[model samples]
Target: MTYYVAREGSKLWKRVLGETKVELQLLGEKWKLLLVGVILQYIHGLAARGVHYLHRPGPILQDVGFILLPELGKERAYISETVFSFMFFSFVLWTFHPFIYQSKRFYTVLLWRRVLAFLVASQFLRIITFYSTQLPGPNYHCREGSKLARLPRPDNILEVLLLNFPRGVIYGCGDLIFSSHMIFTLVFVLTYQKYGSRRFIKQVAWLIAIIQSLLIIASRKHYTVDVVVAWYTVNLIVFFVDKKLPEMPDRSTGTSPPLLPISAKDKDSKSKEEQLKLLNGNSLDTSDRRPRTQVNGKHLEDSNPVNGDATMNGT
Candidate 1:
């Protein structure tokens, strides 16, 4: 029995592995591969920027503009950072969690496909935003001796610091063109639409993302118009991609229909079978048949008779 059980377990493992391999193969020609390369490039560019400026001198004047509006920079960073983190971690969990915990094979497939979709959407948006339009350089200056000065005041250190951190970090991170946060939030909300129980949580997450984006705009880390453009760009990309590549079918239920209350037709069919069984019980088994006999002044037949007595008979 132990050997049989071990053999069964091995077969199940092989089958699951086969399914995973097939799913991966199916994605080889899809947009997911291109998205993966895009993500790699994004990360590499961040690393390169960090190395390029690691030992540079203190922050420049335009850097000061970003530093003062930390809230703004933070809002921008929050959207991208949060979404990217969610997708990356989700994918990690899907791949490693199942192996460690023996989770349902189909659930793993669903998660993998979801992550792939997000990655594709994200990269596609990034490409669009990068090439959309260029912002003018920070060379414009205030008119000489004008009452309104362009540079931040010395006392605005707190504001500068706030803006500085997000801008410096984000610029350093190489994700300045597009909003990762918006893309991820939209994707997650759409993908998990079946989870009606978590609607509040989803709403809150969206609110947080939007609030962060607003802060980025208000603080001047990004122009209000730039944020608007980013938002629209993300939405447009998502819309087009969704139309072209509808989400992969969920595989967790083994192609079964969703669970629902039993139908009247099903119940009626079961009831008919039960009633027929009751009506035909006697004919169901030959062994249950009895030899011919009668009682209470009725004629009867017996296979054998004892002492010529009709009552004491055996068959």
Candidate 2:
């Protein structure tokens, strides 16, 4: 039940050596599902990139949010990225922060599992919505004279997939029906709200999420609708996901059961049965042997006095 803290050295090494084996086993048990979640993320990225090739010159819609808010232009749009990076790393740190406390209930692995579920689901939906209709991207990269706005056709499908593997997402255009940024931002905040306890910190996280959303719009990184759609869609997806998935076991009191394979659990039950059988066998062996007594200088088995009395009365 001992939790490891931030300090690194022999103490941490020993702690990990003692505890991480079961945690790793627990994670390994669901590696296949986790791998699927990972693959879905990659596919989501590929879909987003593939759809980027379909960007075309089109009319920008009259967005009320955009109309009211001033654009920061391309030069200053990076501010949003800065704020987002802060929030992103803050969440990452917070996920690991519980390791330092005695009352830590959640583990980092479970947190990522939930994160993957929410992200993959939302990204899948985003892929469908974005590709359904090519909205003219509102980002600076989608503007005239921008290389990304008019990318040359790829020689083959492999080229499309391979070319986008590492850097294409940065320069890609037209995957903007719903803001991927907001999806991540909102998902992180909502997750923290559920798993974390600090009310003040949660309020600050929500504030940061809101600022990040507004920044995405004001910076022209995404249309107002994209951010707006992301707000509700991500929330709903997380809600449904939480409802569908089994609840994570709480480890705060160290009384929560550890995840075990069916075989292991079966073995435990079998051992208990064997122990019970042994107990029953010992009881039967003891019951079969009656006490012997010397009576009237002769050995005789002890008889129930009540049975002897009843027999005399009947005679």
Candidate 3:
């Protein structure tokens, strides 16, 4: 008799991964880290090309249970194709936005390093799981609403290269356990919050992530479980990366200390003139540092309820 793993297996599996210690001493030293980061772009390009050439097509396992997602596969191959194409490029292009704009330099650099680590780890896991599960990928079938969805069938090496993975050169087999689309999507969501400005752009980035995830599932291109796994996997990656090394903060843009009512100690220790000076933008004590806001005349103290009389009257 054959045995299938219970749903409880998911928790058991995660527990094992959590207990596993991951150590990379290569990045332990500051000098080595600096050198690699300086040339990360070139390294990434080489790695992508390496992965592209290494992929070998083989027979993937198939099962009827999760062959096609009902919600996604409308069989209108055109819609599926269009959504896939759009998401593929959208994900790829967004990865470069942070570097191109150079908004939050440290966050961008940290994100790039973490992403590279995640990619290498994910690719390794995919290979192991592919053999272990022996599950056929959803890419092998395209069905939507009881109709056959027309889809591209790239048979040869050249065709596979031409129709590569959305974010990079990796190609999907019949049943990859996780979705690559979501990985890139979630990565952007993290980097953008730290680096991205303008509320409109941030909102649009989130919208695209939502649509891409749903689109992939609805089109029956990836199993529902695959999408879920991708979400969890990204979380795990983020956690591990941050646990080892905290996210690098940009020193040039130090946060301004918020204006607070003078403490009892401050009032006792300093003169009235010193207290007033501190309350305003200028530094009162020894430091030459100035407040974030440039005060031409009227100070930000006008907006504060700590104005003493203003708070007492409740005006």
The per-prediction CA RMSD against the true structure, in angstroms, equals 15.2, 6.8, 19.9
Q: Any runs in candidate 2 off by more than 4 Å, and if so which?
A: 1-10, 98-101, 163-165, 261-315
List candidate 1 stretches off by more than 4 Å: 1-129, 136-177, 194-197, 218-220, 256-315
Which segments of candidate 3 are over 4 A away from where they belong?
A: 1-110, 140-171, 251-315
Superposition TM-score, candidate 2 onto the true structure:
0.78
Top candidate, metric TM-score = 2
Better of 2 and 3 by lDDT: 2
lDDT of 2: 0.81
The digit string of per-residue lDDT tens for model 3 on 1-315 reads 123465556555664343221112223423355455545534443433333333333343353334554554446535745655665565456544433332433332344565555554554454444445534344533222212222244466554444444533333343345666676566656556555556887787678776776667665556677778777787677667657765555523656332235668877776777767777646755665533422344445435425544655787
Candidate 2 per-residue lDDT over residues 1-315, each given as its tens digit = 133343445565666564566558757877777888898887888887888788884666778878988999878988999999999898888887554444576866777888999999999899989989988877777876677786688878887767565668777788997999898899999998988888998999999999998888898878888998999999999999989988888877678885665688889998888789786543334465776544445444687656555665895
Top model number, lDDT: 2
Candidate lDDT (C-alpha), each: 0.48, 0.81, 0.51
Backbone clashes (count) for model 3 = 9
Error of 1 at 309 (Å): 32
Per-candidate count of clashing residue pairs (backbone under 3 Å):
12, 0, 9
